[model samples]
Target: MRGQTQTASAGGRWRGDGAAAWCWWWVAVVLLLGHLPSCARAGLLESNPGLAYNFYKNSCPSVDSIVRSVTWAQVAANPALPARLLRLHFHDCFVKGCDASILLDTAQSEKTAAPNLSVGGYEVIDAIKAQLERACPGVVSCADIVALAARDAVSYQFKASLWQVETGRRDGTVSLASNTGALPSPFAGFAGLLQSFSDRGLNLTDLVALSGAHTIGVASCSSVTPRLYQGNASSVDPLLDSAYARTLMSSCPNPSPASATVALDGGTPFRFDSGYYTRVQQRQGTLASDAALAQNAAAAQMVADLTNPIKFYAAFSMSMKKMGRVDVLTGANGQIRKQCRQVNTS
Candidate 1:
């Protein structure tokens, strides 16, 4: 039987040795395609770049929420802290793409309250660093982490589907306390905001677009009362509807700094949309920064442009990209923090 089998295999159909050789050759090809060029594929999925992005995508929301919550607490802890964070958000986004440099208190002013003010999200970033270190240490930059955090907070609060921004920005090591004037004041008229954003190399379109941020957050009566009471005229031009304004005044009151500001859209404050523009058209914009946009020739055009959802959506994304590019503090210049409210507490 063995002789017959050997004869058949050698002479015709069953060439076991030949079949084995073919199998090994195909296996080699498969292995090469799957595993070759480790360096070239290093940044691909399962590689460092992929992993870093995944880390940001997965980790950003919790980190952002934690950081934001801490900031709120800090604000609660001290009246100055919330104002600083709000101002920081305004300054950072307006200047260098919201890099949080406006929140830092450096050597410039030890005595000046405004300059020395810092609502440190760096501490939150530091905590994130330690945790990420436990999982994949030294792979993520604090800039990227915080940028993702900010974006996540916006997306989450607005109830938009996850809006992921590009990461990989390095944390800034130094702080600039003197640049606080860069942000627009809640009291500033349309022209003031336009000029401030323009100085930062941003356009009136950006000023209008970013003002939509007021949709999701609450404001103090001290900030909005002027508009509710008599109207800034230059800012709240045409004036808000008397009935609506009166209703708003009832809720906000006069003189109380702690009274809450009304939402711009009145409904769905958390959703990012063109409703903000529509509200401005209706004189329903709540903040001076928001209502003021409609008074400018350039910003008015932007507000009109945003009345079209398609255009507003497109312009909003572009504006966000531009806003994110403002004065980013990066590279050996920033510190990775263990907490969001303090500088490197860990």
Candidate 2:
């Protein structure tokens, strides 16, 4: 409540205790006005004629079931596949707009980028694509497969569909490692994070909500080392909780190997829930970008609001829908690769 302002009723109008209160009051008003519709919100696919819920109804009627079945099998065996797929979908979208460019295996492709080197689930995607090809060859797009696989992966974890993934997205021919610079860095500050989101047409709400995916993932120690071992006098990020810093130090000593890893949400690393916001609130967020949420007043308030499981789920679902639509290739644009790892030679 340090930055929060007090409000009072006076005659017919509400008054703030001070300038900080006025600032917070306006922020609340803006956020209230900007509130997005819930996960059940409809019409996105319908509005875009190129994409549709029943895109493969005539061509590949079993598209949904096939993706779901494969995703469940992989996630069940790996338990970590859900987070990996979600991150894979995100990295794909941010670079070339959810076009499955991240799936390319070229020498200078996005997958070879420094930040993308840790991205996994390519095999899971290939597995899903293989099944789809046999079931309905050349009908389903790799972009749509990536989108659907991500949805099914998370749905498998929650035991229910998280959101509707509209299909008909075509794969892109471009996959430059240089383009991966568009990705938001785990080491970014609040402003940098916001800019990255804005570049992709996402907002502050989307930034906080989508970040909840961190609730179920792990971070490499190399990603956490700067926050734990490099700082002011104490040589620790002051924003990080003291005890939590020591706990991380135990797992990630100075000059920690790139192979070392830690749970992003130490409280519940495998659960897709609101615990991520709670960790950020406690100053125990596992990355610099995660901790940066608490540094901005508006983003901080959004983070606080998202700590509620209900709010987090709804916002995350809506944001996923918006993200799935980013600069997609439809109609006769890009080709659906016969193999996810390479463009169609024909």
Candidate 3:
């Protein structure tokens, strides 16, 4: 899918499939509200008044650059950092609205949850927080660092700034492993995925777009083995492309250890692009949730539409911004943690 050219006619055909209405809705919202100079988007700013485009402009002038520098160095050192950080951010936001609750290290913290056991990049967040602490003391929140680091990590991978992340989020004091259930599972079906997103105020479009992040990451064999070998060892899920199933079976043998990993997008695992959509279209999605996209008519259309790189990038960026705003805590609500790994003692 690397050299494939996105034709205008192809885009037009997708738009004709009742997707144009919601796509136009997003365009109007993004243009009219999202791109404002002050970033005073209604839902985000109106709901969380303390959040702003430059919330730390006076308190921490170098917040964005500091995060970018650390993220750049880490991503350069480890190409896998981007995916880990991005997944970390998603897990953080989904459970508790980008409040950095997932960062807490406690007996029953979100980080200790079963689903989050594999969530890496805590050291990356700690690294960024340490730099911010030196630069601004307690001026910046761990929540904001998580958001900025995720954005910067993706930017580093894309070789450009992907989107603007509104900051000023405060770290929550709570981090319950039980709350991690809010996260969408790799095994969820289409309805379950939609329900999970909808429960977070996200729509179908956001679900489809956010899932595109799989284009760059890997999934543990435990996550995909169930999709590859269901019912009996000899049987494979019929939805999977046979060749892709064979490849997955070879890489992730039956009764494979959870430690084994496979690329989410086999074609271009390291690239941040729309190749995942093509993989999903071909029934080569690495996870059951990913393959679920093709099970629904509307979602399948979205998967088809997002095959266009331009559309995919734009939608992904906007969906990220929207996701970043989920139930955020700002103003004097949550405290700014000096370290990302623990809540404030006082």
Candidate 4:
């Protein structure tokens, strides 16, 4: 009986020891997991993997649909809107990442810059924000909204071509006109354009691809006059189609501080097609920057390659995705302002 009791006690002790050992093993696992990279965790508690696709999947299910709805309405009302909104996003990202810094209303802001002066569509963004705030206040960041609006507007323009956007971006508090001096200018040469894109984490391919945005926008005479009056001696920047030059000079006989508006794509200005690539290849590119692509040996190949609708569309989508990532602040690192035009009072 004594031996049996002792045996039973030993069995119980062994069982307890085994259970404790298992508990300790789990604790070790928890501790190790706690130290993994921020993205490895699965919660909104932190912004690991920084921005993600459909980040508002659970928090705000209607976010994307809402953006598309608002964008489509604006575009429907004004077919010119997609280009304007797309330009707004590009200008925003170039200045200080896609932080909605461009959306901020302030004296002496980036909006004061010459390139940004013509950028419209502020009311559209405001309208979208107002609706989002109504649906899910503080759940979506203005930065993410701007990024999505750009994607949605482009997808709306090019229904056959689309790409996913990674969210989680936080709004920035700073917007300055002075910081934009480094941005690629209409007057930039290939070297300057290459550097400008590189500074913002883009490449030669990206430069040509994103320039496709010009396919649907208008270029002022001021942007084109130089290519004629002050243009390359090699017959209108050597890349411009001769007949197009005559047509441009006819409209822009004299340089105005702001020249007459002409479509970047000579004939099909409103269409978001590979027509811009075709123009560049024919030396009919409107801006010095667009024509410069043909001037660069390597970029010329990309220019030629993108002339194919399939290639240009794919490359353009990829480049836009890459551009969205410039100097972004993700996760809890930045604030989500109630108003995109102003930082939170806190």
**By TM-score, who's the top model here?**
3
Report how far off residue 28 is in candidate 4 (Å).
48
Quote each prediction's TM-score: 0.62, 0.86, 0.87, 0.82
Give per-residue CA lDDT, model 1, range 1-346, as digits (tens).
0001122233332243445434433443344344335524643222222112344455443444444454333333332222223333454555444444443445562213352232334444455556655554444555455555455444322223123344545444444545556657877887787788888776776778767655444455566777755653333324676656766676676655443545455544434456778888777777767777777778787788777655554454445555555565444555554433335544
Root-mean-square deviation per candidate? 20.1, 11.7, 7.6, 20.7
Q: Any runs in candidate 1 off by more than 4 Å, and if so which? A: 1-90, 95-97, 102-130, 157-164, 176-178, 230-238, 257-259, 331-346
User: lDDT by residue for model 4 over 1-346, one digit each (tens)?
Assistant: 0001122124354344545434433443454345344423533224234778888999889998898999877765666676788888898888888888888888888888887877887888899999999999987888888878877776654332255678988998988888778678898899999999999878888899999988877767777787877634334655667888888787666554463677788866766768898888888888889888998899999988888766666566667777888888886677988998888988
- Candidate 4 regions with alpha-carbon error over 4 angstroms: 1-49, 158-161, 231-238, 257-259
Please provide the root mean square deviation of candidate 2 (C-alpha atoms, Å): 11.7
Of 2 and 4, the candidate ahead on TM-score is 2
What TM-score, to 2 decimals, does candidate 2 have? 0.86
TM-score of model 3 vs. true structure: 0.87
The prediction achieving the highest lDDT against the true structure is 3
Clashing pairs counted in every model: 21, 1, 1, 3
Q: Residue 74 of candidate 3: its Cα lDDT?
A: 80
lDDT tens digits, residue span 207-277, model 2: 99888889977888888988876755258888999999998888888877877788899897766768899
Residue 44 lDDT in candidate 4: 23
Q: By TM-score, is 1 or 2 better?
A: 2
